[model samples]
Target: MRQVIVLGAGLAGSFLACRLLRQGCHVTLIDDRAPMSASRVAAGLYNVITGRFGSKTWKAETLLAELDAVLKDPFFQGVSQFIHPIHIYRPFKDVEEYNQWSGWSAEPAYHQLVKFEERPLFPEVIHNPLGGIRILPCGWVNIGGLIDRLQDIFRSNGGVVLQGSIPYDQINMGQKTLTWKGEPLGFDQMICCEGYRIRQNPWFEKLPVQPNKGEILEIESEGLDQLPFVITKKVYMVPGESGRWIVGSTYEHLFDDPGPTEAGRAQIEEQLRLVLKVPYKVVGHRAGIRPTTPNRRPILGSHPQWPFLYTLSGFGTKGMLAAPYCSRLMTAHILEGAEVPEELRITQFKAFRPT
Candidate 1:
């Protein structure tokens, strides 16, 4: 059996590990954190329609089909993977931007799903000036719960998890072993799924890492209990279980600290207050850095020289949509020598080297 070691048990690592395990591979997954990752902080929104200046979501339709297929697979039964249509109310702050996306995605399937009929603003509850339309086959992921369950499933299947930091310098290519906590573990291949931390990696020193810091707040409110759906304006209000809701997220690219910032907190509150007419209490706040690449595409593939070295990260803000698809692709490339899609290949980095 081919042995694989996955570094960083984040969304990419955990999901990919599960796939590999199902394929009957011996796997060891590691992460410094106990369990939670940026995935935990994410609202896990998967939208087929996205882009600011009017660009199509990268392979969203294709990915969503795969996600739906897996959820229905007998192997995934009892996992309770639920997917639902999420209605997005994006009030066109920039009409020019809205017009730009109007003609994009000429695909027949996408065109069929487009509903030209909708209200500009919600009649009740809130206000919208620019008008909004809805997108289908999009919704949230139970990421934290998914990861926790994956951990249990992984351990039960004889998969190993070493929970602690594994320094990149400790991987001896010539020796083909990783020394973690003074224990030397050998594997056929090592795939680093470390998120923002990979920016400091020497081997991939040139991989563009635009650390986008995002903050989100969970709140409890009364009279807003009617919101069983997702709402989006400047900020979004996603319905959580009970009377709680998730309102977020402010994006700051140049921030140094990953901790929740007072400015970000205030910004979200202001946005929430504007969109939400009802009173709400801020119950929790959290933040994390999204591992965005310069090109905004996931970085995947094996090192040209060191075939044993690989990576499956850089899912960016769309990890929820990107991870599941890319994980399957990465596993296929590793196992069957399948060609990595030109779009996501790490070779897109001209300056990257295996050594």
Candidate 2:
């Protein structure tokens, strides 16, 4: 029997397969492989300090460092070239805000990530009069490209990758067999890493998974590619290849279709124009639903009733960093009988038995 079977071959699923393979477990991945999934539509941003108040995110520093460590592993040496540790410049709204943030930036606790600056970046093309501070230990990942490359590597070693959905009704958990389109396959264990689509999986629908829809745009503009890093306010602009710049991300919790909309495009364009002074044309637009939780932490553990059945989801928008580290934790918990961190434990959800 195959040692493991993973559902939804996105970032979390891909990382889990890599981890299990490293531990000598025979593994297979399953997914429908949608091109415009969350992992593909995401800007892959890794910001430390976010939100309206500009405060640091939960354990941002530690997670950033852990991401660096994961990327340095032998398997990711030359292949994972998409992880870019670029600088993020947040322009101050006014002199008062600049003075206020500059004081906080001077504190020792903010040393690694906060850096105060006087001059602006690309003054000729940006409206950065109040100056800005650079957010260090931040960057982005080309998640779509990374996933594709990892899939190729995974398949090269006789790793099985089923390109269609599994039939839940035909799954015989008692016999440790899965029915993929009427074909039965045996596996010792199975894990579900389905992101926002987890609601479709009856076993995990009650776990408080919140779907957050996000939209981003790709614009083509000249003379701005040399800006060197990402810039932010309500929206952020990041450097892209070949004179293309990526501006993003508006979050909506009340949308119907998980597709691009005129309102979303307008919102991004209006905000992007305020901070940017350059001429540009909209080249691309995309939208995806993120799988988030109220607690803002990843949830990973086995089913209370069935030990062989497991789940791994709720990395939210920060999956780029969260998935790799949490996958390691999950691997250790599974292969070595180690305890999972309290925050990430699935038992935290009320009465997790199958319905």
Candidate 3:
């Protein structure tokens, strides 16, 4: 069997490792389990129709199908607890916006993905004066729970799991050999899925990996938990278990730190107040740095100089929606010598070219 080492145990790494294992590779997965990692803090919201204009996500159909297959894999059984299916209610800003959605919903492209609502669905708790559109096949994944289960599954299948960071300085790489901290690791290849921490990698650091910081808040309200669906406007409000609700996510392309800030909290609360009519108490606050790309596409494929070193990252806020499909592509490329699409390849960036 081919021997491989996957660095970083976030959503990207975990998915890739599982895919590689199924391909009959002996895989070793390592993670530091850092505090406030993106996967852990992410709302894990997956929606086909997103953004201010409500455009369909790129490759939504294929991505969703791959996600379904991954979730149904017998190896990942009992992961249903992390999957929460719910529609997303996007409030219309005005009559013109409502008209736009009504027109789009009639088209074959959006016939099943979206539906326009002429009357306000929840006037008592929401500020939707002009009604909204309900987006189907949208829901939130408990990323932390899913990762934990995946790790357990990996271990149960005889894959090795190491808990700790791998120092870049201690890593020694050659044309056909690799070692960590002066000890040889007899692996055929190494794939790095370190997310925003990719900046620390010497080989893949040149690729355009922008770090985007985002913050989220958890609040407790009296009857808000009764809402069985997600609400969206300037921000999203996802209802969790019990009376707790998740409200957030402000994108900061430029930030001095990655930790939660009072300013971020204030911004989240400001947006939350605009949509939520009920009073709530802030129970939790979190922040994480996402590895985003300028083109908003994931960067995959191997290094130019070192073919054995590959990278699969930069999914940004859509990691949960994209990881499953991308992992399969990475696995095929590694084992079957398949080609990665140009748009998702790391070599598309000028910095990725070999000297």
lDDT of 2 at 198: 78
Model with the higher TM-score, candidate 1 or 3 = 3
- Weakest lDDT window of 10 consecutive positions for candidate 1: 112-121
* Error in Å for residue 330 of model 1: 0.2
By lDDT, rank the candidates, best first: 3, 2, 1
Which ranges in model 1 have alpha carbons more than 4 Å from their true place? Answer: 34-36, 53-55, 81-85, 92-109, 120-122, 129-131, 353-355
Report the Cα RMSD per candidate. Answer: 2.7, 1.8, 1.4
What lDDT, from 0 to 1, does candidate 3 have? 0.87
- Model 3, range 52-84, lDDT digits (tens) per residue? 888999999998898888778887886768988
Question: Pick by lDDT: which candidate is best?
Answer: 3
Worst-scoring 10-residue span by lDDT in model 3: 174-183
**How much lDDT does candidate 1 score?**
0.75
Arrange candidates by TM-score, descending. Answer: 3, 2, 1
lDDT string for model 2 (1-355, tens) is 3479988898999888877876778888989987656787888888888877888888776787778877777765444587788899999988888988888898887888888888876788888987888998888778888888777777765577888875677778889888777678888888999888877886777777788999999998886867777898778988764466789988887888788889999999999989888799999998988888989898899887778888889988789878878888888888887998888889888867445
Q: lDDT of all predictions, in order shown?
A: 0.75, 0.83, 0.87
